[model samples]
Target: MGQTIIEKILSSHSGQEARAGDIVVAELDYVMGQDGTAPLAIRAFADLGGKDVFDRERVAFVIDHSAPSPNEGVSALHKLMREFSREKGFKLYDIGEGVCHQLLPESGEVGPGSLVIGADSHTCTYGALNAFSTGVGSTDLAGGLISGKMWFKVPGTIKFVCNGVLPPGVYSKDLILYLIGRVTADGATYMAVEFTGEAIGALSQEARFTISNMAIEMGAKAGLMEADDKTFAWLRRFTSRKFTPVTADPDAVYTRVLECDAAKLEPQVARPHRVDNVVPVSGAAGKPVQQAVIGTCTNGRLEDLRIAAGILGGRKIHRDVRLIVAPSSRRVFLDAMAEGIIQTLVEAGAVMVTPGCGPCVGTHNGVPSDGETVISTANRNFKGRMGNSNAEIYLASPATVAASAVTGKITDPREFI
Candidate 1:
């Protein structure tokens, strides 16, 4: 009845009255960076003759992407980032800690009622925990690195209400992909995204993370769901930090609203190059797939692995397709191993890699051939995004990726399930 999650986070950072479309300067509660983009900001920081970052401890640098670089140039770039972090008093998250967004929440740096800015696009992933987070460019990051405060034109929010339940083999990725067809890529540009409805309340933290993580593809500043009991219960195991929950005001004005009674959804896919290039599952069926890779900050949870494993338990990967999988974090990886998921996947002809954002970022591992096509569980199918610019990439849910791995072609997940 008061304000939405985005509004509450902004209010905590703003002392005076705040309203949508107002250009307000708010001090960032957390500043995040990863290997690929951190060095750029560092270079700009030096060019500005900055002595030390504003509130060094609040700035976080992560070495998750291309950690052990796939090439020499990438390795050198990572070295520069390491040097920058060592010189600055920032909290540099080194290799093995995990992806930037995951480590942010895992370290308790992302709390409720805080505004966070990250150099990486998927920074909105933190919104699952009720923080207002968004991505920024290196230039803006440099400004924030020098001054703790940054400018944001408060964005109007579009509410997405989901009711009913998801069928087996379906996930948040499917829902978002389907919605992209409705809203397109630029639909939410400069607009905050607030997700509601019973399905959202019932989602696991991992599942919710999947939704908020991909919100960036919709050009969304942030995506938030009500932090109800499930979120609180999950946080209890991770931190002792206490904070107030923020939700949308009953009468909050939304520039637009989307409603989906999720029970009607089937496995959905976004065909190559653009997140908004969405179509029904049947549209992509029977198309030959040369590779099937799973794992990313989104849909890299243990539950995602379990679903793929159940489907691939006794089957071998398609003769023409390669199957690879990566866990989201060390914790998720450990849990999967303890439950024999690793063995099941390996036995079923899948390659299990370390926990990191590899294929998703298109830097390390899982490089496909020039003309090959792949069915990926990671977000984004941007042309040349996965290596060879000419290679085709199709984006889909884990179930679809798994089914394709077994059949060597894009098949509706419903058939396999």
Candidate 2:
């Protein structure tokens, strides 16, 4: 009879009691779109005969995917977004600012118990802050912009109870990949996943973001987590907003429950063509690689960079392999520079690029050649995900990618650690 986290958040926003499968119109605290989706959303707003947005301060646009205008066509779209933001007096993040998911939390547009919707599937990333966030189509995003509210059918919750301590060489990425492999890509379709227990609670806020960012990969609507002192501390560092943390009732209903032991997990990799086609590092070890990428919206935080630098400090990558490093945001880039993490990576034969969603989206940089293999820290690994169906992608933790970069093959991070 108790409400889960998603139900409670939706109820608060809708001004009524909400239950799974109930349709309600909930007020939105924030809405966002990036270059990849903003053009369509802007056009949709005009098509809807929308005038000024409901709130200029609550709507934002970020130009990150295919940043710096990969081609004249993308440049024109960026120009349109810029003009629209200027005309509407809405906030706009220009090139190299960061991915929308990373920038939103950094700018404090998201907080616990807030309702957020974005034009990007990874908008679910904000759920790490304990918000009820999900992705909407361009038309839905336009409606939310014009009216400051959107409708939702409350989703049933799937509880993932992870216990025990993570091993030294393992991390949140490995744990998430392992979970995805178990559940398969469509296992949690249209449902909300609530990650809990000691292992998840022990992770850093950034790590939690990585987990939430990938929820959509498993066909989840949103990923929710409980807030504690660590969550508040992380929020305080960005904004002074007061947030009321939400927790599920002890007897909240769940569609299914999965219990995992973190101590039993090892580094995991999702082979090409499908994210769910995952295997342990040893299962795919020694496979040759032509490129290795160490950043994305999922694992491009400062902690991720430090993990890579720790392995490549006094070493150089394989001569046959190309290592690409991209910081997630300008702040992360500058902080890494101040701490010499950037220098360590570059001196170790890594090529540093601007902070944005470059290689991950296959928009502009680091596109592999035909018949080549790449190991990356990005979330997805479908065919042609990196701009070429002929080039294969292997998804792994940053440590695994860095270690593989050094050896020109798929190598286990535990060996390097």
Candidate 3:
């Protein structure tokens, strides 16, 4: 079949051929729920006359957003979800450990080629594991609970080629930020992005994920890369179960095409509330930074940690600001400790946290106070995205964030070296 990555993934879940623009109702292998959406989804499921979930063990209900449940409204929602999941027997990961997407993969509930649905917008994070995953609203999730399926209009694919060696400070995060800046948030609306070329082949699964994780920021439905040796290596560590590796056909038709050159890039950031608003680190240099978070699903991988540790190895964070580092998974947390990255960060006064979706999603652990200005590695810095309505978030790569943490200001990473 001359299919693209999106079609290949969807076709596996569905028993029939799936092409671009075709309507599909594939059975969900897994469904995910987090605090903000789970409550409404469960309520909708009850309102729609669904008896029980399709499968209790197959569903993951996590308390991610509003982690400590900021106020009574959010706390009540948390209470309602806990009661529902426990009563109905759905898997519940209470307010502990990793973000929803980070926790799902860590628990081994999802695998390559599996179809997963979630009630959160960042649900696309599962694509890092080569699963055909996407986000859905609470209402759609309510319907899927009873029917065990959901409708998706198969999207056409876009081929993105990345070539050449990367510049010293340029990382996958900068690459994606640059791409999103150029493509604009709506550039790939309704399309899947398939990363190719020699550079993508050279990247680790974590690096590839840094690209796909922000695909939605560019308005792409799913961002995918070829399942290569790196993908297999990551999978091997996570799963002993053997499975076939899926790849797009050579002649797969694409709706659009774009290419990226890593050698020409530098550390970039998405300023303010919109992800599409990107600029070089130099432009944001000398700007004041009251906080810096160096870890999140978007940049919480091992290499990301190494980069930050290297920068913070000998320096302490600015006394005027705060720096928080959270591992993406238990595995990642353990690896960092074994590699001494953890010590380097903690010695520098960084608040190392267990793997959880804290702070990044504007929940607990790292919420900025009102009028605070912070530089972070997480995606999205929308207005009030952090708890305080007056908080301002500037998204940057791990290197930039680490450097800014050390300098107490938004200085370019190149300044540190």
Model 3: lowest-lDDT 10 consecutive positions: 237-246
Q: Report the lDDT tens digits of candidate 1 across residue range 32-90.
A: 88887887888888787778888877888888887667778988888887787778867
Per-residue lDDT of model 2, residues 1-417, tens digit only: 999999999999999999999999999999999998999999999999999999999999999888888799999999999999999999999998888888999988789998999999988988889998999899999999999999999999999999997899899999999999999999889999999989989999988998999999999999999988888998998999899999999989999999999989999999987889999999999999999999889999999999999999999999999999888999999999999999999999999887888698888789899999999999999999889989999999999999999999999999888
TM-score list, all predictions: 0.96, 0.99, 0.94
> Order the candidates by TM-score, highest first — what do you get?
2, 1, 3
lDDT values, one for every candidate: 0.83, 0.93, 0.81
Question: Which residue pairs clash in candidate 2?
Answer: none
In candidate 2, which residue ranges exceed 4 Å CA deviation?
none
Across 348-372, the per-residue lDDT of candidate 3 in tens digits comes to 9999765766587776777898888
Give model 1's TM-score versus the native structure: 0.96
- Where in model 1 is the C-alpha error above 4 Å? none
- In terms of lDDT, which candidate is stronger, 1 or 2? 2
